[model samples]
Target chain A: MSRLIRGNAVSADDWTELDDATAVPSTAKVIVSLARWRAERETLAAATAIGVRVDNSADIQTLWPELRDLPLVALEFPKSGDGRAFSQARLLREHCGYQGEIRAIGDVQRDHLQAMQRCGFDAFVPRDDQDLDDCLRALHEFDLAYQRAARDDLPLVWRLRRQA
Target chain B: MYRYDEYDQKLVDERVAQFRDQTRRFLAGQLGEDEFRALRLRNGLYIQRFAPMLRIAIPYGLLSAAQMRMLAHIARKYDKGYGHFTTRQNIQFNWPKLPEVPDLLADLATVQMHAIQTSGNCIRNITADHLAGVANDELVDPRPYCELTRQWSSFHPEFNWLPRKFKFAFSASLNDRAATRVHDIGVHLVKNDAGELGYTIYVGGGLGRMPMLGHKIREFLPEVDLFSYLEAILRIYNLQGRRDNIHRARIKVLVKALGPEKFIELVEAEWAQIKDSYLKLLPQDIERMKGRFDVPAYVDETAADDGSYTAKLAADSKFAAWAKRNLRAHVRPGYAAVFVSLKANGVAPGDVTDAQMDALADLAEQYSFSELRATHDQNLVLADVARKDMYALWQRLSELGLATPNIGLLTDLICCPGLDFCSLANAGSIGVAQDIFDRFEDFDYQHDIGEIKLKMSGCMNGCGHHTVGHIGILGVDKSGEEWYQVTLGGSAENDAALGDRTGPSFSRADIAPAIEKIIQVYLEQRDGAEESFLHTYRRVGMGPFKARLYAKVSAETEVAA
Candidate 1:
């Protein structure tokens, strides 16, 4: 179950898992990643998107146009604590206007979905081991913000001070 | 003190959201640990040995009593019951959870404060002479320029990504209490024969591994060109500072590599282009900023008020002693600057309790202009208290156990929190400080011994700034045991110099006795009480003190030799 919790309001879990054995059509879509690829461009290019483990922030610009055109771009979280990707995500949206589904995959905890949402992570592929229902509750950590992100069209602080 | 304008507020508010997003992504696996550590450190957060620690910024060490109370409340709710003030005069909370940081920042925001640039490779909190407006010796208040530097340096486009942390300290008077010589940039506010408020800028000074005093490149940079001159120096350093090794990343290293003559030439080259830029001072804006610091009005008083104070002074011998030592004369006729000792017996040198913070705020409101200043020597000050009110204020402060009457005496020591809080320290400085304080509790006896500057650093990194103390003690590790090293004749003034090493290290138990021996030697050989401990040591040298330290009757007679 995977339902969105917007702001402080929590919604019930509603996402269903699709089993690999049950999936049938050739046109069926599934999230593929860098780790899942067995070979080079011959096989890896068949996936929806390619996730590069960015150490420094310079890599996003190098791979921008391909990622911009990809139908599904699942950004890999190599570890649970690295933050270079947030800047990368911002560059994709603000600088590149990346409109593809920016899915957060790997080590995705329930407590992190809301922030991932704000940083333009529209979808998430939760780790297969964690309970899916618990991950959705991670969204409503805070209902307010002082800055704008990809989630909101206007920076809240600008709005407040402009009115002031 | 300059209050935060709308621009500063918006910057911090946005930065908070930025940190929140960074924290979120790191948790969800979009970001990694090492990268987040750097980002979190930029926001002044560190995961300590026990829990997360937060270092809060006290801009130029100027905070109102009300602001101090807000810090006190934060300590009570989000951290342990107390906070440690560093040599740079910032406060550090030993216990804070990573999850509550946003809330903690919000709490600080209510008090017009945040932990911006307290750490990381960015321009740090600007510092100035703690006795800024009230000190009689000062020609001009350094607070306005410090505030200007604070705003200019914050979120600097290029300097934010400097190789290592940067610190800038300013001094406007003869007595350089700001430790200006040992900062990244030490600005000495000076006046030419014409009485213009110019600055003598010293660049590339720092104290970590290779402690170097800054070299002056510009002698009388007028007030209008101060910003341009500073910006020139920063830009050069940002471009040339070594990035290969973190230890070699400071501006000192850059300046050292370039040498002083080359450094000055490079700075001048950069400044020539920006001398007329918008960053250069506008006279009206300077006036606008300066207007924020107008002195409080004082009423005329006669010697009759002085007579009553004299009677109170006569009635309480203790009060007389405290008034003589702890009180400083102000430039105004009926005003005095009050010294509040943070170094009480058994407590850490700079630890202030929540109760004390509240009391200080009350005292500031009732007496001074609701203002307080944190000195570099780990003392808080009420800047403009009336002379007539001094006796009553002293009595009230005495009730709070703060009228120590040991300012600049043997007990007026600077100490670090060392092993008790800092993970990088070699020894427990607070414990040694307590032991020394208990040993020298008799104020009269301490006063009789004369002014001795006893400084302790937990480690060689010099956050405790032991290198510039009159009697400097550096905690060292030898064979897994904590030992203390002694240095003699250091001073932070017009003739500023680093102390010379005394001898081999002493064990934890031997530290106090070692200090005692040095003082004992000073007492035995001083020319007079007028010659303070530092002067006597400078005249006599460390040889006499070293002889007295190791000449002790060792209880080992060939048992090991």
Candidate 2:
């Protein structure tokens, strides 16, 4: 519910291709989270990963672990400030170690890429008209960080000492 | 005073230059207002009701005289004369221009100080018992640990972007003067059975709209595991904390919802993954920091110093009274802790003028072993002053009106800088605070009145820590007019509890009389001065105080009572 952002098309309630894994594919085939979020998301994740998209709330306890091995995981960012997806992306890469394509779908702006990248999302799936140049700049912006991020193992302090 | 080392100097210098660049970009219109908003706040600049207010962190409220001179220089050159000392032991200049912040920060950098993490949702300045190294009752000086935490938390990467601002306090003694119960993370440093220092960690406590005391998350967490454990807690909160709604973002609500046991499991699990890593406290690093805070040189002397102090007392009763109130044991012979009160009558609490700050710095340099502290009560504490130098110190401090000698009395109030500066405030806190202070100026009466805490906040934000004061006054605005609300029997000691408000609020003029009535009732019915007001008030019920506060209104409502 937090990802509900208002713009051209995406809403929080509407899941991308691989965001949620659905049991009843016949009923909700319209939505699918890219890279298939079914594998990386564990059932302990408080939310479920249904068929291809749109998981049931009650099934999150069971389905999250069931979808831990999905080859491709697509995390959704329905809103700018909605940080639930940050947790989702992190759980996929760090805990679940889902190494395939982790596309940042929906409301993935240039500014938010830093946190998203730090949290472990590899590839960004921006809007068609969005500038790729700006996105690339954000990826290369700050070369060092102080905390242990899902993406980088070396915190800034260690890096500082290494240089010394 | 702890001098800045190479690392500290480099960090501050780089930070100022970075801010200077950021400020230039913003003025050049490269960064939009919203983008620049967060950036400016990270540099401790905020757009307030009047002008841009800059909050500078007085880390644990410890600063050398020369550093204070630099602060005074900043106030004179950049700000509008004075600075407000916050309840959290930090100071804020109300009228600094946004454009001038870079230069101001540069000025501070020259003195080895910068306002980094003073504002924003980052680790705030660490605070401890004001009488840290010198308080007679202290187990071990908490300043080294405070310094350690200060260094670790400053610009810490992973925890910087927390859901909300985190406040951490350390207390090394049995008496909880640091208000550990009400901090995000409270560390109680204690010696274990094996003669090793360990900590009892309290998490989730904060004072805001949802005021809740922190729960003990970790008991006997060894000193070595401190930083790693803290990092684990931050990571858990950062990853799992609800960032959707800011109101529910503080770790308090998260800990409340998750339950402390599960939260513990989560943190321990996280810590296990990161323990023994680089974040672990190295013995040498701690030793280096501790060495800097070595005990100041002490000269041996006895209580009966040449019969000179007693002679002064015989000559001057005022000096005797002042000595009795302001002087406390310094854990060293021939030295005493001098309490320089900022709570002068009719003045804003904790606020000192640029001139006064320079004078205090000069005095500290000359007499107080070059060290001063900002007490939680918003007063100044000279941690080490010679016992033989009392008269001279008093004379100099009295000249600048700094030696009020009302350390814990009526004039030593904790008040918020309400509607005058803060737009979030509902009523004027300064006026009521002034009224309370000016009304209780008689030294004998105040001393006889006994140790009482008068805390006032403009609203329930609890900036003045009204919840812990014995006589808590909260400001409420009713139909464009300010009314003062009263609460009794609150404390911030080991036996800490929130004060309870009486039935209704009072008009500004009636507040002093209501308090007077309550005190009169206590005086008439209480045992003696040895029994503190809070102790006596709690021993009895709020019934008496409540009854007196509402006596007139209750009389009008009832035909006969």
Candidate 3:
């Protein structure tokens, strides 16, 4: 079983990720590829607790119409160095106003956790080789940030200086 | 110079601590070499030819006297009693040990300095006009914007993993001293029709194997929208820039692939969404940043000149020669900016010894307002020296061997730490520089040659900015042997152009003679002493120079046959 981090804690994962080839079980809390979702939208429409997984290259603006109805949007990082997912996650949150859980999936590691968090990824399915506890600690590596991002409550230090 | 606030200091401190932990983890065998490499690179620690090289960011090339002392200390303690200032206006400690890099960074933090984002596939150090505030020609100061951009791009969560290294340069002068046309993002501080301050933004400029000048994407970006617009451009680049091929990964390639118009459209579309977001700068925000860089306490010098300056010039031709080449026009009357030439003969260009650095720091304190600026041409500037102090300062600098009387001459060439230090170099660039310096040892000869930018790079990486040099030299490897290629008529200034290749490559032995031939051709072909080398080249269009360069080789070949 994969270790999943939700918010700040390692939590038990209930959602099942199914690739494009897999048939979706009607009653299960399942996540499917964006392609499969498009193909079987009418069928998956009645199913509850459904999520969609999109590639980093997929334009999030195209999914803005359906973002509010979705509970989870999983962004892929095919390689750890490929940071397109960070932009995707930010656009989903800041521009698309995506309020649902943004999950980081493939190749997610401890080093990327804090930055991923800042970019609005609340759920991280870390790679199997990484220790879950170590990755959990990485989420809070930086207590302060220089700029305001998806998480508005976190201080924008420069703006705070004006008030001070 | 802008001082670091509590927020800036805390960020650097936290970054050092984070890197310390990361280094510890790597040493403890928890992190693999590949993983550790990525982490260390962002902190500007590179496993170079012999030892790890740590590049420290002197943001916008501005350094305080205390900071210079710290650099001197770091040089003596950590490096080989010397440091190399790079073309990007940062300093490099070549012999830093890997395990001790975190400690070095921690030491840097005490003086509001860090190596964060100095390397790696991220935004590198932001550079601006070295003559930012003091130049008489500047319309506005560009350092405040550079500082603001520096803060915004520091560990930017989204941009830290760009497709390749990104660089930004800012210029506000009519003459482009910062080489603004050849950066990833070149910002020119300009005024719109309403006389309101704004930026004219250039995108996708870079130099490497494929050197391309930046294209103007935005004619007028309102001052308040700097960050938001920068974010939009970086966002598009991060999301869409090519990553499969390392050579083709720079933003320049993306701009080339999807013509400039499409790139502008995408950035504008993204900017429209986040323009009014938290990243927007309010009037107070601009004022707050501007306040940090308010002009230094310049002494009233209207009646300060006691005619001794003119008297000394007439009395000592040596002092006059130094003044003619080394002194720059400052906006403040009776005050001048001084260039402490790092191109003194025999030493490596841009290499300052520990003792020299310490003494230079003292000189900065005594002359300029305890502040120094590093030029992109691999030299340092004391930005505000009184005209009366010119003779005294020159004497002190000459005693230190820092006054070389060659500022823009052929000898004051910009060079990279080539094969001697860099693992990427194909040949040793410093030796070639020395040979040329030895050839042109005569100051009278160089002064007659007049304002030639001779730049060289070890490889196609163009770290020495060979592409933009008026006379460019590139080191190439041929069958495990080093060969040098020369290009002529390139420049990094307002009329920036890539140098044209001058025939075939030359061996290490013949490179200096080949350069002599090129200069000989220029002297013979030039219109008059009044016409610069660049102007003569433009008028003649490389025919006479190329013929003269290759004719001797053909004659030798015929003689051998």
> For each predicted model, how many residue pairs clash, with residues at least 3 apart or on different chains?
8, 26, 0
Considering only chain B, what TM-score does candidate 3 achieve?
0.99
Residue pairs in clash, model 1? A2-A15, A77-B29, A81-B32, A82-B31, A82-B32, A82-B33, A83-B31, A83-B32
DockQ of each: 0.04, 0.14, 0.74
Q: What are the runs in model 2 whose C-alpha is more than 4 Å off?
A: A1-164, B302-310, B558-561
Query: What TM-score goes with each of the models?
Result: 0.78, 0.86, 0.98
Candidate 1 has an lDDT of 0.74
- The Cα RMSD of model 3 versus the native structure comes to 1.4
Worst 10 residues of 3 chain B by lDDT: B298-307
lDDT by residue (B1-561, candidate 2, tens digit) is 667765677778777876786688679876557656766777788889999989888887888888888878888988878888888888889998878888899889888787888877678889888888887788888888888788777755445566777889889887888888888899899877898888889998877667778899987888888888987787778667776687888889899999999999999987886677766776765677787774676666764244566678789877888899998887877777889988877678888999999998999888777778887889888888876678878888888888887888877889888999887788888888777766777888888988888888898778888878888888888999889888888887788787887879999888878878888888866887788888888898888887777878977879764
TM-score of chain A of 3: 0.92
Model 1's CAPRI class is incorrect
lDDT of 1 by residue, B238-324 (tens): 556776687898899989999999999988976886687545666766676787664576666673146667788889888888889
Instruction: Give the range where candidate 2 chain B is weakest over 10 consecutive residues by summed lDDT.
Output: B299-308
TM-score of chain A of each: 0.65, 0.59, 0.92
| lDDT tens readout by residue for model 3, B384-490 | 98888888889999999999999999999999999999999999999999999999999999999999999999999999999999999999999999999999989
lDDT tens readout by residue for model 2, A10-66: 334433352244442333322344234345434323333333332111222234564
Model 2, position B166, has a per-residue lDDT of: 80
lDDT at A2, model 1: 50
